[model samples]
Target: MKFLVDAQLPVRLARFLESAGYDTIHTKDLPHKNATSDTEINSISIRDNRIVITKDSDFLNSFLTIKEPYKLLLITTGNINNLELEAIFAANLQFLSELFVSHSYIEMTRDSIIVHY
Candidate 1:
């Protein structure tokens, strides 16, 4: 699976995904890092056929309209740092990947993961 880590996530998560053998891109590492907006990120995901990983609620609106994203993984833990966010994903990689592979939007909280097809 291909993934585009949004600005809210640490670029390191992209490295982790790459290590897991999935294609991944970190927006912070791009040439126009500071210039890229959420819309641009979504557009890139659409063009490259990649799933978007974000903590931003704006994506929820975009997904509602475009619905072209392969999948969306929205982390709802709130204002947490990158390390904590990474830990959450690491702890639930299997379950989360399954949701993505099924091409669904998943809202993950501390105790539960809700999938919307």
Candidate 2:
């Protein structure tokens, strides 16, 4: 699966996904870097067919209200270090990949993965 990592997330997460053999890009790689607007991010997500992996609730709102960005992986694991976050992804990567095949909105908390219709 392809992914677009948002600014609030560490670029290493994107790198990790890449290392795991998925096509991924971080907001820092964009023209405006982390300053890239959410609208632009959404456009890129739609254009590239990338699932947006973000901690931003705004993305959650957009996904619920308008179904933009094609798909979303919302990170709700609050205030953790990058390594901890990466570990979470590492542990759940396979299930996550499978979930995205049929699910468009998924939320990752410290303890669980919640799939939303």
Candidate 3:
């Protein structure tokens, strides 16, 4: 699976995914860097077939209203440190990859992963 990590997420998350053998890119890699707009990110996600990994509810709104970004992994694990966040992904990355194969919108919370049909 491929990923487009958003501005609110740390670049290390992207690096973690890359190290896990998934193709990944963080917003900082873009020309506009973290300033890259949600619309543009959505466009890139669709064009490149990347699943957006974000904490932004705007992408959730767009996904529900217009199905943009191709797929989404919404992080709802509020206020955790970056290392904790990475640990979550580390423990769940393989399952997450499998979930996305059959799901378009998935939510990751502190202790659970929810798959939305």
Candidate 4:
């Protein structure tokens, strides 16, 4: 799976995904850096077939209203530190990998993952 980590999320998460053998790119790596606009990100995601991993509700709103970006993983574990967030991702990525095979939208909290097909 390919992932485009959003500005709000840590780059370490992208590194972790990359280390796991997935193609991953954090916003910090983008030419525009973390300032890259959502539309541009969406365009890139669609063109590259990358799943957007974000904390922004605007992406979900865009997905709901326009169905762009192709796929999304919305991290809903609010207010967690970067270490905790990365830990959660590392721990649950295996479970999520299965869901990604059939689902396009996933919301992961501190305790559980909800998949939307």
Regions of model 3 farther than 4 Å from truth: none
Expressed as tens digits, the lDDT of each residue in 24-107 for candidate 1 is 998887667846887778788888888888888888888988884556888788777767766777788777777777656988
Residue-level lDDT tens digits of model 4 in 5-104: 9999988889989999999999999999999999999999999989999989999999988987779999999899988998898899888889888888
| Cα RMSD of predicted structure 4 | 0.9
Tens-digit lDDT string for candidate 2 (1-117): 899999999999999999999999999999999999999999999999999999999998898899898899999999999899999999999999999999999999998999998
lDDT of each: 0.80, 0.96, 0.96, 0.91
- Rank by TM-score, highest first: 3, 2, 4, 1
Cα TM-score per model: 0.85, 0.98, 0.98, 0.95
Per-model C-alpha RMSD: 1.8, 0.6, 0.5, 0.9
Q: Which ten-residue region of model 4 has the weakest summed lDDT?
A: 63-72
Candidate 2 displacement at residue 3 in angstroms = 0.3
- Positional deviation of 57 in candidate 2, in angstroms? 0.5
In model 1, where do residues sit more than 4 Å from their true spots? none
